[model samples]
Target: MMEYSDFKFKKMQSQLQEYFDDYFSKEDFLFTLDCDIEDVWNLYLDSFPDEIKGIYHEKPWHDCQRCHLWFKTMANVVMIDDDYKIRTLFDFKTIPEYQDVFRALDEFLKTKRVENLFLHDKHSVGVFRSFAEYDGGFDENHHFYLDLPEKFYEDTENLASELGDALTQRQLFEDTLNLISPDAVDTVLELVHSNSLYRSIQWKDTLEGLKDVFEEFSQLDSNCDLNNWLWKKSANLPRNITHIKNTSMGTLLLDITGGMDLEQAVTNYEKITAPTNYQRPKAIYTAEMLEDAKSKIAELGYMDSLERRFAKLEDISINNVLFANRDVRTTLGEGIFDKLRKNVSRKVYNFDEVSEISLDEFITNVLPHAQEISLHMYPSLKNNFVSLIAPLNEDAPSMFQWDNPYSWTYENNITDSLMKERVKEMGGDVDVDLRFSIQWNDGEWDRNDLDAHSTEPDGNEIFFSRMKSKRTGGWLDVDIIHPEKGKTSVENIQYKHKENMIEGEYLFRVHQYTYRGGDNGFKAEIEFDDTIFSFDYPYKLSNKEYVDVAKVELKDGNFTLTSICDNKVHYLDHAVHWNVALGDFVPVSLICYSPNFWNDNEFGNKHIFFMLKDCINDTNPSGWFNEYLNNELRPHRKVMEAMSSMMRVEDTENQLSGVGFSLGKLGMNKITVKVKTNNIQRIWNVII
Candidate 1:
């Protein structure tokens, strides 16, 4: 990572501040810059290397698997994106320890600066050869992709600066075309830029992209020179092997040495050394090069014509697309590739660099595994690990499990005072004894300094500094610290004043203040109490309930929202309350204006779980689904507690920003978000 001077950071930050002060403060202006999910992923990756270098190691692999992990982690940078099912990067706010990195958020925001960046023109999946000329042996097919973010251009100066970077790279490539030597560079550039093959959206990392292509092209004509002796002209021990069959010539011609004797054909053999000082000629592009070139070019798509474009070339067809599909496995009392298993122990490192770890540990730690972790890396050999298992198998290491992002264990035994009051109203004795406690378990090495805070009814705040407010009687009895390295620690926040806790409402919170040492293995929870609303601090919900919807709580790792209406509890899980990325919303009886947290990427992006207040289609009680919703969907504090106990999902971050395009203010109420869920939209008649 190049050292980014603090001056540069502050300079960029100042420019952003200037733009915000000049434009965002306006009363009549609407945001002109907007990006979608795909664009968001690209923009983050483009600028991420510079920003994250101080934190993460450079990408270690050149394969497609590595490519996919790159995208997943990039999505993690912008809290909105994910790898469809899971969060590869836990987008925790930068802890206090890395305040400088946290403050340098301008780099992250710069991703949204899309003045001259190209949009993703091609969204093809799978790997294939690159058409661009390259001699580097590392020129492999693409199984993963990286695209630039779609930007809304409102600033010309910012746009010009960015456009300059990409254009300069192309100029350098063209200038090299004029170089005196390096015919392979010219050969590749000529083929790739010709009308027969061209790609408008090649790669955004121009400098890196050009360098990779050049390296691959450079390998086009490399010769094998062993032990300082040239192995030239050998029909049996062939050097300068050409993959193409142009001119009907064999890959190379072996030296006859003016004799047809077997002993003379072994000129470069261990016993003979007639030309030990000779330098082998470097390989130039030939018909044999065309085949691998086509293979590499085929990855860019349009594979059928590379044969037609060249003469005397034959193309062989492979039935399957996935590398794993080509893998061979045997089950005749033995497994395929079993012979190789003896040498394959649990490896912790690859390429003899960096710490080595297992696949499970890598994903659990949210680290990058896109490059080396492949089901089958051998393009032809493939993966046969799954073929050995039977259909009736009870377990398979290859099985995929969809795990939740958030988790925690709480004391379910606690009796809520509010519940006790309702029980007494039903003519029952109330000698309740339960204190509220929320605990968090982080990763082993995680230095998660999460603080517990409670705002008492008497305007008292209890936290690390004021552990206990004298007047408010609020206390943070256990301010747990993160365990030492190699140790796992659980932190707890307890609130138990017995009857004295009844004076007023209490807002309890647990937040990660200085998040160091780990990724997503974070869990948080809460013990049910009268104070039902809790959020990581600096994140608060609007108490003003929109319609009947109120702020929900994360209890025992479940995502649920509940509201009390006519002393009945109307509650729903993440599915009923949360919408999917596919632009869908399941409206329950009532909803609130609580938008998903766009926390500190904190652009004022408006989001609503339900329809706008006036937008609700009030024509109720029509379908059988509505009947169940009205009758069985009872709204009460107790019912909410009951539902909370029954089921749970991981408490995950829900940053909604790109969703704005689908529901831009113009058709926010009119646009019908397609609901994708098993349950029907729940509607109730009771008023909150």
Candidate 2:
């Protein structure tokens, strides 16, 4: 009956150290320790110095039963299984925190270590070598693998006292064991000695079997130096010793001594210490880099001095100018990255820098570049200057509207009012609550009949088959068969009285009845409950093909027109065009005209005026003139110039400075235009 405190672990430690020293002194015999999982770690550490550091200290041991140890030194490799299921001592429970320790240990053991202590041994060292019925120990021909049966509480009944102690001690020794340099020596030794099942491995195999297992070890060349391996060989010890050198290069020296190879640590040090060749690009004011130019402009009331004006202009940014011009923004906004030119840097000139240059130098160098508004950047720069002083000068043109450039291009501009006028001039009835009209001609006019159909609010329809709705008094008044060949034809549906109309949606459509002419283009005008809209079908419609024109809502005397087809033009490429031959209506042949010319026009100045030869010089006109192109038809010098250029006529007063191109035979006597109004050719013929 010995008390645990009187067991003298310190005296046993001294005896272990002395035994290791004496054992290593035998030069001919290579020794190996075969112990249980508990005592093996303590025995291994007893042979090494107390300050010795290794990956063994870096990681800790986890569950022995669940995770078996796979160890690899430079010359030896072994996989050891805990014959006793260690977890059963703690009630067969898992400690999750120690799982990380096992994972790390398992990973490190798998890798090849070139500087391990086993590399110094002449032959393989048998660790945890068993000599019982359970076969273990070093076999050069085979790798060690031991599969033992799991022991439950019934099997572990003999060690019930130690098992109970383990359950209570688990929390106290939580995550404390290291697989290589284990610290829990007392607890492990206590458990191992208390269990008699593994006592045969401790005494019989560890003591007697060593002689039988290593019988040829004395005959082999056991020429390892114990003193040199332990103390003399500097590389044998782990690099945990931190010593500072008395030089400027101490940090680099430390890294070299700490096992960091030259490529990894020294290369980076050279890069940091060496001279750099990199030079950053000079900062310039791009359009994005400018400060808020709009706020600066808004703050200025007026500038009386040229210096003040120049200073304000200098402050103005390219962004404000670029935004002001619709053409530049659109051109650059779409695919700006793809369209941007490389190395397009421009030097910014301050007020003083600009003032330094003479008028002659500026005119020769800057003015020519500045006036090139066609370039993307010039317009931005020019606009900024104009915008800076535009508020002060009443006579100056609007900020971005320099040279009267069009904001947008051409579009279909034929409206309901224009169609209504054309209808009246063609002797067709337009005064009604609802009207659906269709007119078409091919110039080589054959007997082609297009029919206009309207479904009244009461569900009664009016067309060629049923010219009159009996229920609603809606009539297809002018159903032209185009019986004669030389004239443009018309078809009209009208509800002449309000009493005949019902308070609901009215649907209007046009059907191409007979395909007799080469051109099947047609125009449709819908007017219902005081609302009106017009559509032009420039494409040839197949026989019996229907065009759903519009839906008209009539409620409480209010009228709303909703187009059925996607008729509102976005781009000119998709817009429908109708060609009308004005044979003897005008003296001039026509070319394409700008629809957006009026956008750049100044207030109180008549910017657009084009005479249609015999056409009246007024807002409302007769004959098929280019109404869509010249939106406001009045009398002006700029308009006359634009008209002469488009018509290819000689403007003797203005010198015809504007540019023009032919619109399919601009020199011909018969001038044709894509008309959107109903029977435009007929109106032209009647007017002349």
For all candidates in order, the CA lDDT equals: 0.28, 0.34
Q: After superposition, how far is residue 337 of candidate 1 from its true place, in Å?
A: 63
RMSD of each: 37.8, 33.9
Tell me the tens digit of each residue's lDDT in model 1 across 1-688.
Answer: 1123323433433443343334322212111112343453444344344445444444322212544444442332221111111111222233332344333433444344221222122332123223223355343233332322223222445655644643443333333323312333233333233211111112113323433544544553444221011101111111112211111111011222122232222222212321232221111223334455444434533232111110000110111001111111111122322333344443333232233333234223311111111110111111000000011111211110111111111111222223222222222222212222332332345555656566555667676777766663445544556544543343333443344443445554445566553443333333333223222211222322111212233344332334322212223221211122122322211111211221222123322222111121111111111111112122221222222233222121221111112122433222222111122221111111
By TM-score, the best candidate is 2
- Cα distance off (Å), candidate 2, residue 686: 39
Superposed model 1: Cα runs more than 4 Å off: 1-441, 485-488, 519-522, 529-688
Evaluate model 1: give its lDDT: 0.28
Tell me how far the alpha carbon of residue 51 in candidate 2 is from the true structure, in angstroms, after superposition. 99
- Steric collisions counted per model: 31, 1
lDDT of 2 by residue, 1-688 (tens): 0122113322332342343334332222121112243332233333333333232343211111212231222112222112211111111112342233333333333332211111122222222222222145332211212222122112334445644433333322221111111111221222223221111112222222222212322343355332222221222111221111221122333344455652343334334432232111111111221233223323432121101110121222232221112222342242432233222333333322113333234323332222111111111111011101112222322222232211111111112344554454344567777788776773556466778888777777878899887767787766667544554567778777767677888888777788775454777777654434557777677777777777877777766775465362111121111111122222211111222233343322112111121211111111112222232221122222222223211112111111122123322221121211111111110000
